[model samples]
Target: MPCRWLLAPGKALRTRFARPLRCDVNNSRRMLSFLSSMSPDNAELRAEVARTRLSVAVGCITEVRGADAIVNCANEHLVGTQLPYINLDGAAGCVFHCVDGVVHKRAGPELHEACMSLAIEEGSYTETWGGIRCPSGQARVTPAFSLPHCAHIVHVVGPPWPSDAEELRDAYSAGIKAALAVEGPEARPAIRSLAVPAISSGIYQWPRDMSWAAAVQSLGGHLLEASLRRGGAGELPCPQDGARSGLDHVIFSAWDAASGREVEECLRRWVDGTLTEDGLL
Candidate 1:
């Protein structure tokens, strides 16, 4: 018989099913109770989620060195070459230059045409969350030339932000969902997702806190739900032993010190039991 999987809210699961994996079943039950007793508040949960997202963002800045795919906060034109580090500083420039020269050389024109077809303009690029308009039907493949250790480039238009806009929130949610869906059909055993600071907040004029909140909520919700489904329903692909392949890890890479500090503080509160009971931290 196939194994079963279940999807439950993180809080509820932590409360009702926080058990240890042990050879003996009774000890596991005891462990669950202990964890339940220590559950954090919703506020704390929200804060922690924000902090975790921030940490992942910071890590992404450095994590690109070994990832299979790195999602870019690309413009509608896919004119990634215009970016400061990629274009100006030779030392920093080569870091993101994928090995596949074609992807690097052609990404701009190819992305531009796709955006134009969708009626998305350069001014509107960061405003709306544009989908990858590549000619290829697959979301994982980008026109950028491949780089060492990195197999693919996933292009997702970060939702242009007033930061708090519902559209932006939806875009963040959609982006994560899209990435997760890719792994759903693949034979690969694992995949990773990395997000840059969405548009609108930086040069786009979006609010920072709201943008941060939206991202955390979307990614955390997806991860928690996906983990449950994998563990309970067995819908997720697993290894030959029948263990499902879910998000092995999700990271947020902050590009600067301020961003990094903000993320770390939130994480500290979550782990230290400073968050509220409702899980909103």
Candidate 2:
């Protein structure tokens, strides 16, 4: 169903969706208790949303099922170019290189056409790197095309090596916000669940720990901002109808087991107060 924005006096702008995912204050407390008892892979976001759930897992982005959107760690060009390491083996040896190539390969040439449309028709091109579509620290949204079990793809450009931590954080924040801003039929949020990869840690060569830190910080900052807007002290806003569609899930889909573990650890630290907004090291 389509979503609409709810703006009330002295209230934060909330995304309202059709189906009701009820979470009363008591239910929210129970949910929080249940989350704390669960593993770090299923950590608490502290957002206190009626239906939002945070998760970290090791899996391929293409394999993630049921998410409304999946984030692509795209380069500035948005052409879904493979990493050099895989290119060395020749196209016959490897079909895809990084997350961008993998997602684009799975979604077919139509995805590329859509990106090109955004670049040319929509004028999303940037002057960076001798001119490219979708600059660093920003995000663009497109149809998922042939990707199974997904509705949209949020393409985000991460900062290259030697960039500041804020750039990396902005990359993530922009992706999440882009998903929230995407409007489907009748102006509803195009996506509620977003599957994100550990961007820039792969070909961009950012340190794993630092990369995860920036990601966690961005996640926390956005969610916390939402909670504060709702005037949440220890309770989540839970209305009978028109439940907020403000990100039901933000799944951290790691490319490997080790990266998944790192993401979970960083999330756990955030939940335990060991990590803060400026936690990037």
| Candidate of highest lDDT | 2
Model 1, 166-276: lDDT tens digits are: 445455554554454554233443345444343224433344444554444445545444444554322443454122343434565455566656444434444454422
| Candidate RMSDs in order | 15.0, 14.3
Clash number by candidate, in order: 48, 1
**Taking the tens digit of each residue's C-alpha lDDT, what string does model 2 give over 1-281?**
23334343344765422333345785475346434423353234352431345677677898897689999988777777743444544653334457887898899999988887774424553443224668788999999999997989999999865466656777997898788888766566667678888888666666666677777767654555455455542344443211243565677888889888887777767766565323333
Q: Report the C-alpha displacement of residue 160, candidate 1, in angstroms.
A: 2.6
lDDT of each: 0.42, 0.68
Which residue ranges in model 1 land beyond 4 Å of their true spot?
1-66, 81-146, 181-190, 193-200, 231-237, 240-246, 266-281
What value does the lDDT take at residue 232 in candidate 1? 32
* Alpha carbon deviation, residue 38, candidate 2 (Å): 21
Worst 10 residues of 1 by lDDT: 11-20
Q: Candidate 2, TM-score vs. the true structure?
A: 0.70
lDDT assessment of candidate 1: 0.42
As for model 2, its CA RMSD to the true structure in angstroms is 14.3
